[model samples]
Target: MERFNKSRVILMPCRDYDEEEIYRQLQVGIRLLGGLEGLIEKREKILLKPNLVRKAEVDRAVITHPAVMGALARILREEGYENIICGDSCGIGTASRTMAGTGMERQMEKYGIPVTDFSHPVKVDYPQGHQAKQFVIAQDALDADAIINVCKMKTHALERVTGAVKNMYGCVCGLQKAKGHTLYPNAESFARMLIDLNQLLKPRLYLMDGIVAMEGNGPTSGDPVKMGVMLLSADPIALDAVFCRLVDLDPQMVPTNVHGMQYGLGTWKTEEIEVFTPDGEVSMEEAVSRWGNPGYRVDREKYGKNIWNALKALKIFQKKPYIVEEKCRRCGICVESCPVEGKAVTFKNGRENIPVYNYRKCIRCFCCQEMCPHKAIEVK
Candidate 1:
């Protein structure tokens, strides 16, 4: 509603997650936003929602870097805010194990903070939504006194780039994320739904771990590239718009940001965005030229809606998941996460525990591809 301070964003140069260096940088970034003095009062419980998407090491950049988050937590602790907890509803397993695997739990535990699973969720109604009318949101998302959405900068197969706005999708709890994909199958429709979710969650602040970000096909399944910058924002839409610019991509092509503007989420125009760094306020163009990725971007399928819808009806998009037998550990997670009523991918093919996908029944949501920890499932 406030328009993310008219697209004002703070950019801080951070090359690594070294304990001391990152702590100082985070302080500077927070101070740029008026520090905790203006934002949070002492003793207020703050929820740190980091990107713990399917439990990968921080080096992979699939989730927010643990060191970045830990340092921020410590900084907040020193700022007189002691009650803190890190949480997310992971894709496949419980939140506790995912936190442990991604190396977030150890850092958080160091600061007397507990990692809780947003497992138990409550249903919410959104009559004012553009495409989404109702949702089941994580109770922790609703219960937190304030939410600082700590997101990883990455490419998403569905939404193109996964940034601050897309990170809140984790607030919907586990498999329900799959249900969301199934409910709103088209990219435009799903992006609008994400806007609805963001409005409901209403994160007060946004922070990004861009020291190393995932490029190409990601969110999971991509290579990490050195971007070496941390970002802070009051508005996610504007934050994402700046990010799209940094990556040399058109922000209008990013669906969340496109729909975000229509929903009054935040500004999507980079030209209108006011960027700041230690050197002082910088123009968006200068910021991009100085600290931007010209050659890196997420993969996006090129097909107009009419063409895509035509092919989609015929199931001709052909981006269906196929398991690599050797890489497959027969975990059955893909089978479990499928939102189809009869289960699109099944273990009923009767070959020990290996699963098979009946592509005809599949919705092509890539839930299987996204959840596979072993990288056994590949979509073509």
Candidate 2:
């Protein structure tokens, strides 16, 4: 019996002005890997899976940039690779809602790419296991001959950073995502589950949209920074390593990357890997210095201040909602989304208003944070 060889990763900087130029640069990177022709056979069905986490605008850095998808699809079409479809199963909601809320539907129409909802799913067993016995993946994702994983470069509250490796979680289909969270419970276990899922799916190609990246508390509500870079790879682990380095993050600290290497997914150490750029070649250190890490840095002063406030406002500020009033619509969705058995969050007025959260009973699962329709909730 023969062993499967590890995949290769290609890195490129996107200093281009617009979408077409960025796409062309990505094409250059892919060409280094024997081009898309080798990856996509003639008349084979291809699935372009992007990181559409929830129904949020594209510019918010919550999902993959439509421009990147359009560019990749255009390049595929030119190469005679038809039967392309765009799809994703979100974190806690339906793909349809994510598509509509994120304006991905409009992008799909513009590119003439069919948007698929991976709703009806099938179970796939993994013989060599790290955590899970089987996963319920969307049938279309499993059946496709080729899958192009398009992921947004963003920070995650749990996994640290969600990139090429983490995007494969979308393949789980629907609410199975939330269920996976419940099953794994902790970040370390959840990351192990992700590695197992990636091994099972084995996407043909992976692309990271780093032109604009999310920093701080993300994968959703983070500040968008201009990274002006994009990455392509067949090896998800290698790509994640490069992403980590680009952001000045220790790859070992990232749960997904650490577990991925342990599971024989790909290499995490920068010393063993080689990177090829679109123009003049540069080291991972230089790229990170130029681009800057998008992960959050804790403010010691702010932490001290919050502690003082918690002590001072013992009643109201004990566990008060640190709402981003700018982002808050006061829709009271968080109040309703709270799963407290005793109705911890109750309306202040007769009409819909931001409900006060009971600090003692708050599970801190961020279910309220995850389900907030208005993106209002935050933990201090």
Candidate with best lDDT: 1
Off by over 4 Å in 2: 1-8, 92-97, 100-103, 293-367
State how far residue 312 of model 2 sits from its true place (Å).
25
Q: What tens digits encode model 2's per-residue C-alpha lDDT throughout 1-380? A: 01124345566667643777877887788887778877778788889999877777777778888778778887887778768887788765666677774556776777678887888799888878698888989998998888899998887756667898889888886657656765775567888898988888778889999888887656576678878888888778888888878776778888788899888888888765666676655666766676655444411122235668566445443323456757767776666555566655657554344566666665444546656656576655
Clashes of each: 0, 1
- State each model's CA lDDT, in order: 0.83, 0.73
Expressed as tens digits, the lDDT of each residue in 1-380 for candidate 1 is 24434667888888787878888888887887767666666766788998888878778888898888888889988877877777889886777788785557888888888888897888999999999999998887888877899999998766778999989988897768988988998668889998998888788789988889998657787789999888898889988888888998888888899899988898888666788886688898899998999888665455567878788789887567788898888888888878888998998866576798898898777878788778787766
In terms of TM-score, which candidate is strongest? 1
- Decoy 2 TM-score against native: 0.82
Worst 10 residues of 2 by lDDT: 295-304
TM-scores of the candidates are 0.92, 0.82
Off by over 4 Å in 1: 1-5, 324-326, 347-349, 352-354
Query: Which residue pairs show backbone clashes in model 2?
Result: 247-293
lDDT for residue 67 in candidate 2, whole number 0-100: 78
Q: List the residue pairs that clash in candidate 1.
A: none
